[model samples]
Target: MNDITISNNPDRERFEVSVAGKVIGKAWYKAYDGDGQAERIFYHTVVNEEYAGQGLAGRLAKAALDETVAAGLGIVPVCPFIKSYITGHPEYEASTVAITPAHLQFLDKALAARA
Candidate 1:
């Protein structure tokens, strides 16, 4: 397995995963203020097609969520990929917030389609 490097690009509001100096995946998020606290809303996650099925997306998602937690920010997993990931990994649940019923519905459909 290639050594993947995950880094936060604050200017772009995204976390990126790179292998051999080439970007293979990214998780985009937006930062906002809510209830007198900082929050992060993950909206999209993408791994390069060539890098698909290599676990890059999961690595990127973990890195992004870890960063959010480190920053003391709540998370809203609007992105289906992220929602699905967090569902399987409940350890990150403490940092998650603002997940609506619609998000769960989307995740259920997405999970079913994947199955």
Candidate 2:
């Protein structure tokens, strides 16, 4: 509920949201493999630690998702937070790549093996 500003930089193809001139959140996305798959984007993200728990990340995600929908792109949420957010918000479900429990198990195993 703060004075947040959201901007979509077409040149960079990312949407940014800031608070008081400080960038607190962002959604990075692009056309998949230069294919005209504008209806599908790969995402990477982070929310400022100071701004965590304020729902700022969700707000930013929502804005980006809305933009992606407007642009007709399905979402490939590579960020864990974004993936979790989609699970809770069914509105974005259709645009998401389903990450089942099996996927988590595999990821955990892969990470542990590397450690």
Candidate 3:
């Protein structure tokens, strides 16, 4: 097994998974500032095709969630991968928040701004 590592890239707003110093997967998130708290909305997760079935995605998700919880932020799992991952991991329930319509609206604006 290669030395798999994961780190949060705040500038990209994603958690990156790397192997042997090469990034091969990422879990993208957006932040929604509300009520003096930051909610991290995980909207997309992707692992390189060559790295599929290696559990890197799960590792990446865990790292991202860990960092968010550690930072005292909420986790809004808008991505199916993240939502399902949290469902199977009850430990994250405390930090997880269900996605709302407002979240979708916010994402639309964020993505559009980037485009």
- In terms of TM-score, the best-performing candidate is 3
Model 2 Cα lDDT, one tens digit per residue, 1-115: 5689887767766778888877677776654522344343435677778878887778888888887777677676766777777888889887665544544454456447656
Q: Which stretches of candidate 1 lie over 4 Å from their true place?
A: 100-115
| CA shift of 105, model 1, Å | 19
Worst 10 residues of 3 by lDDT: 30-39
For residues 1-115, write the lDDT of model 3, one tens digit per residue. Answer: 6688899999999999999999999999998885677899999999999999989899999999999999999999989999999999999999988778889999999999999
User: Backbone clash tally for model 1?
Assistant: 0
lDDT for each of the candidates? Answer: 0.84, 0.69, 0.92
Q: Which candidate is the best by lDDT?
A: 3
Q: Taking the tens digit of each residue's C-alpha lDDT, what string does model 1 give over 41-96?
A: 78889999998998889989988998899989998888899999999999889989
TM-score of 1: 0.82
